[model samples]
Target: MRTESVELTVLCLIHKNGRYLLQDRIKNDWKGYTLPGGHIEPGESIVDAVIKVVVKRKKIIYRGE
Candidate 1:
């Protein structure tokens, strides 16, 4: 039996206040202050993933270009 694995990442665009908001790997993965984005789950789009992470963390909505 092969165990499938999924990877999640975060990408952040910090402001000039020297404040960075990224993700961190927890266990055997790259669990650290990554950017402000993550992997896309089934049925979830790329933009959705980023928005979820950023809004959930910073409590603000972003209108990406």
Candidate 2:
């Protein structure tokens, strides 16, 4: 029997007016503009994961809905 591991990730789209927020990835492997997001931590909710990633990468804070 063989086992496979899966990783969960999330991406958020923040748009206002006619513009959307994105990150500029200058790394050699992946170089381009992408939305702010990252892999979800273990035992973390989807919403929480997205929030954490967004804050860490984009420096944006969530103020609740």
Candidate 3:
């Protein structure tokens, strides 16, 4: 029997004034406008993963820093 591994990922939807935020991906394999998100790192919580992905992808400044 063969086994398949599952990977965990997260996606976030930011809505403001009836508008939603999306990312315009230019990579060859993933070229298109899509939601901003990424895979969760090992031992990382879902909330932390969401924050990290959003900040890294969108270049959002951390107000708590």
RMSD of each: 4.8, 1.5, 2.7
**Model 3 regions lying over 4 Å from their true place:** 61-65
Q: Over the stretch 7-61, how does candidate 2's per-residue lDDT look in tens digits?
A: 9999999877999989899998979999888899899999989888887667886
What candidate 1 gets wrong by more than 4 Å, as runs, is 1-10, 14-32, 61-65
Most accurate candidate by lDDT: 3
Candidate 1 lDDT, 1-65, residue by residue in tens: 89988775546575647876555667666655556565667777666776776777557766554
Per-residue alpha-carbon lDDT of model 3 for 1-65, expressed as tens digits? 99998899998887769999899999999999998899998899999998889987678765653
Provide the lDDT at 35 for model 1.
60
- Alpha-carbon deviation at 38 in model 2, angstroms: 0.3
Per-prediction TM-score: 0.44, 0.83, 0.81
For candidate 1, the TM-score is: 0.44
lDDT of 2 at 15: 79
In model 3, residue pairs whose N, Cα or C atoms come closer than 3 Å (at least 3 residues apart or on different chains), thus clashing, are: none
lDDT of each prediction vs. the true structure?
0.64, 0.86, 0.87
lDDT value, candidate 3, whole model: 0.87
